[model samples]
Target: MSIQAASNSEKPPQEDNYQPPSSLSSLPDDVVLNCLARVPRSDDLNISCVSKTLRSLVRSPELCRLRSRLPKKSLYLFYHFHQDSKRCHWITLRRGEKMITSTHDYQVEQRSCSLAGLLTSPHFPTFYSSGVSVGSEIYFPDHGWPFPSTKVRVLDTRSGTIRMVPSMKVARWAHKKAMGVVDGKIYVIGGTYGKNQVEVLDPETQTWEFAGEEKVQCNSRFSAPLEDKVYMVDLEHGRISAYSPREGINNVATERLIEHMNCMCVVENVIYACFKRSGLMWFDTKLKVWRRLIDSGGKATLCSFNAGKMAEYEGKLAVFWTQINTNFVEKVDIRCRIIALDRVGEEIRGKIESSGSVATCSYSITLSHCLVVSD
Candidate 1:
């Protein structure tokens, strides 16, 4: 939803006839403006109908300024039915913006549910599990594990819609976090048959070309982008490799260990890894050591991330996970949590700001990705 920004020079018009409630209008202007910024645009019509004071607040330029300052951490969940590959379903884990559309190959349905978000995928959970979001688009190679292809699919987070782009010239067999964006271009970390080949995609032209191959130690299923370079971690040998395409440098490895990691992503230049059994961990590039994540209370957080996916949301860490509902008939619950992170000297702390189930579904589902997009 879009709202025209009111000029900052003019103050919100005061109501000459209808007076607003004293409890609200009595507050300081800046505080009132911040509250108005949090109000959903979908309710603008209702807010206008309520009172003239409210309408002026909605149209105030200060509202836009405060809203822009607020972090826009829109979280989208990607999943499809267990029996279909011709379709992908993307659902937002927040409340508001209900949309339903269908493309030639995929069916798009999105609703920000106050309860839980739903997604289904029969595409095998072992591969094609998650995607990397670049701005408004999320890129995933057509390869669905066990099978490799040159095709690619892109999802738009604005309406929870998805579509297929032109196929890449070379098939990318990489899975999981093998895709990242550098300088606005989508980069796939691995090439056909686990080679160190990289494929670059220009979203504007919907075209792809192969990048110079780097001497990577092994075929990594997951990779991350940081500081203009891509990183691949090999925990078996305690090596976290960094590759620089801009500088044409092969990735340098530091000491780190990760095993059974469900997903890993970069947040504030730190690489956070989530395990199914273990809670959360981050790689310390400065000390070249791996540390378990600590909460604000200086204690380890007990979070079971079984088949979980994570992304950066609103300048904070957003965690998504799925669990089978035991009390009811075969059903799945998609859960979400927002974590505010803090740094104290050498230790990084995390505090879960909010936690709840976003959606519950009757059908068994496999979560493919959890993406955080800006509004």
Candidate 2:
């Protein structure tokens, strides 16, 4: 059978060449994935690594439902390094893009976690934690000192999967604690739990109840999730409260603001306060009034901007930064940048500033929920 192997078994395959590229020619795979999600997060991470129709249009969910019907989309930056063996870094920005497109389309997903097995108490540990995504799940809780027995965790950011809940009798933890997601329940406000504790968690019944603990504290100054109401701000002592767990443990403190607040959110229904170093407020829940608007340069030093790890992405208000312990060989080049705040434009003042300052910092931020799409 040798004639170059019998003409290679009589070569019986040849369809006059090839032709397969017309799915109606050009656009229309959901409009080429909404023009590649408005491209520019460094060319959508290099066209999601080219080929495969652009890694299925850069991991599409109908391109996140056509970027939630566009009001402006693309901004995902999550960087956590309050290390105990946990590291995080994410980036995606396409709203008038350019902060060097987040240091050139950032993406460094890592995992080797352990905030001490998420704490049961290494004598109370957890000095900075905040997260709340819900729906695809992402809830966080844990603030430490010589006090932090109340812990909370519920992540499935897609499926890094984890569930641990139980801690709301107040054990202390408030350097800026505030979380909200009313209806499916998850309202935790006014940290430093030794006195102003208001907690609630029910990620479909993982339970961690207790909603009442605030008889006046200095750190009850940040908690927002409007619609069913859940706004708490103290600004040191100018107050601003509103809670309604389907109308039960009612609370409605008010003293108004004078300034010096530094973090808050409630988008769409409005209640965004960011008096970072001083300046920016907008609370009008049906005219309670406090409009100031923009000005965060009074003293400037928004403490690495971590308003409970703020997030309203695609519609603006994306925040991240809490991990600076430099000089352990420069903490391996310490780099975390995810701040895209411009839902309607106002405060991005001095344009991206945050360099150093972390005294006695302990951290943990886990928001695992990844499925790209494959049913």
Candidate 3:
């Protein structure tokens, strides 16, 4: 009896010592990365806290490459508000799975993503200045206004870390300045009051170099990088100029594309510009011609009170417009329209795939700046 009792005690101890399988930890690095890549980037902060391996994977370059392949698309909107003081917030809008009907019709739903501690950093910039995003980082030029100081604020979307990077060679506020990122270098075309100079910054080295001086006056308020060249729109002259590091600035196209452009974004190597009254127009770099994109049955019409901003989202052009009403109880109505482009014969045309009002807010909300970033 004593021997049997001792054997039972030993069996119970052996059972207690047995460990369960760690399915996740045992997964291959690639498999683990593939799984984590599908997760929303906004949740990376909390996801990384799970373990050291996960934290490293979240910051790994391979994971970013995997994320770029995932079918799910996320559009992050960064907006600045200032009623009494300067403040900014990042709102993530994700496109839900497409539902198809038996009639061969489909619908895309846009929903706000839950982001916790993503934009809560104290170092986030509050001022509304011109900015550009390259890879996973966004750079904002902060030339001390009223007082000349050279400083650039850089925001890393992955970890939600905002830090000040090396300033530009010259102290220039990004307001009304032409900025573009090419070949991993940030080029800033400065010199208001008729003097045009080009400065380039290498983020890798955290250094700035003078690219060259532009012969033509770069008075454009918007600039975007396409392929190897940078396109700058001259609203005053109704011309678009292409700048290359090897070659100087050259006028590519000219059109009276309205006196003022609300915002501009590049999609599929073509530049699209939005006007307050004239509607939407695009510039064809291949033909060096400007053509009006008809709204195809009033799909994109702007009111006098509507303020519109355009951005390239997942190879499609997205326009976000907000109408503010002082008399109405509802202060602002934010509307978004996604346009998909297709070639109808020889002419390229866009059709509105999805359109709806995304959100509404009180009158106290002041949208100073907006930019779309993919996560």
Candidate 4:
């Protein structure tokens, strides 16, 4: 026996047969591009880290154009808390699948669920005014404060990018003013105390012009986008008004006084306004009348903590609000719920679509703003 010991440097037999896992690059260029287009906009950052090919695809403008054509739609709720802090915490709530019960009724839990993403960059200016969502973009017009110059900040929800656009011609903040999108243009109505000006900005042209000054100033809290015009509620005058780019502002004289309305949103040409004490009400443009829908139940939970906000989520009206419980020791649980509503004749039914909660030492959580954007 010559004691022929195997050389220490000899490689294992299995090592020679090993192969690397397949990568996205192995697929055809078009196939890979289509796959990347399907990824959620918020997950683009993570997907780009997979490989060099994917990194290139994600950053290309062509990818964005392709994504816009995809049939899939995602609903996102963006809200901000803590207005006094220098850095505002922006949380994003994604609309999740509804859970069906044994009785065939859909139940949306009233709790705080997992967050889709968070934005706390200093670049995100604090906005006391409501934001208008155009397609996949949300425009926040900041009140001229720490900085003298007034400018509009645009957040591309699809790409998770934020940029500052040209300053408004009037250099006025949207404080207590109405902002909405109509006919591919952004209309900012009302202004600081005693300033009744209507400014409209065309994103395509990147220019702002005064729409017109009418006697009826728009109530910021009760205005929303409807078809080709913007529908607004004149609580003081006990009437509803519609502003058309071609015909100017015209009031729909009515006896319904919407002064107590806390928030409003438009769905399927119907204007839904939520009153703190009266629950939900819908304004019929065809009938020119305000009708009461469902009484205050789960819908009222949104306004229980602070003033709730409403947005259209996939053709349905969605309301978001916070609830605080102080039973725990040294910790307060703040529950957030998103309620979705369905239209059935004059009756509007609601279900809790998503719920999440967070425990903190603070007694209550205040929701300063809310917006719904499609991705």
Q: Would you list the C-alpha lDDT of every candidate in the order shown?
A: 0.64, 0.49, 0.65, 0.60
The TM-score values for the models, in the order shown, are 0.70, 0.26, 0.67, 0.62
Superposed by TM-score, candidate 3 places the C-alpha of residue 163 at a distance from the truth, in angstroms, of 1.5
Please report the candidate that would top lDDT against the real structure. 3
How well is each residue in 1-375 modelled by candidate 1, as lDDT tens digits?
A: 224445533545563355756887678878878887776555577877877887888888878788778756556776655655545555664433452221111122354211112112225223443366777777766544555566666666665555668877664454533566788787766544444456688888888776675533344555778888877765346356766666553546444454577777888888887875677878788766667788898877636466467777545677777777777788887766667778877888998766666667656566777776655
Q: Which scores greater on TM-score, model 3 or model 4?
A: 3
The TM-score obtained by model 3 is: 0.67
Indicate whether candidate 1 or candidate 3 has the larger TM-score: 1
Output the lDDT of residue 205, model 2.
69
**Candidate 4 local Cα displacement, residue 206, angstroms:** 2.3
Candidate number that wins on TM-score, 1 or 4: 1
Least lDDT summed over 10 consecutive residues: which range in candidate 1? 112-121
RMSD of 3: 17.4
For model 2, the superposed segments whose C-alpha errors exceed 4 Å read 1-9, 12-30, 33-35, 41-94, 97-138, 144-148, 151-375
Candidate ranking under TM-score, highest first, comes to 1, 3, 4, 2
Tens digits of per-residue lDDT for model 2, 20-82: 666522566776777766654434666766677777777877776775675433333344444
Error at 339, model 4, angstroms: 4.9
Candidate 3 worst ten-residue window by lDDT: 101-110
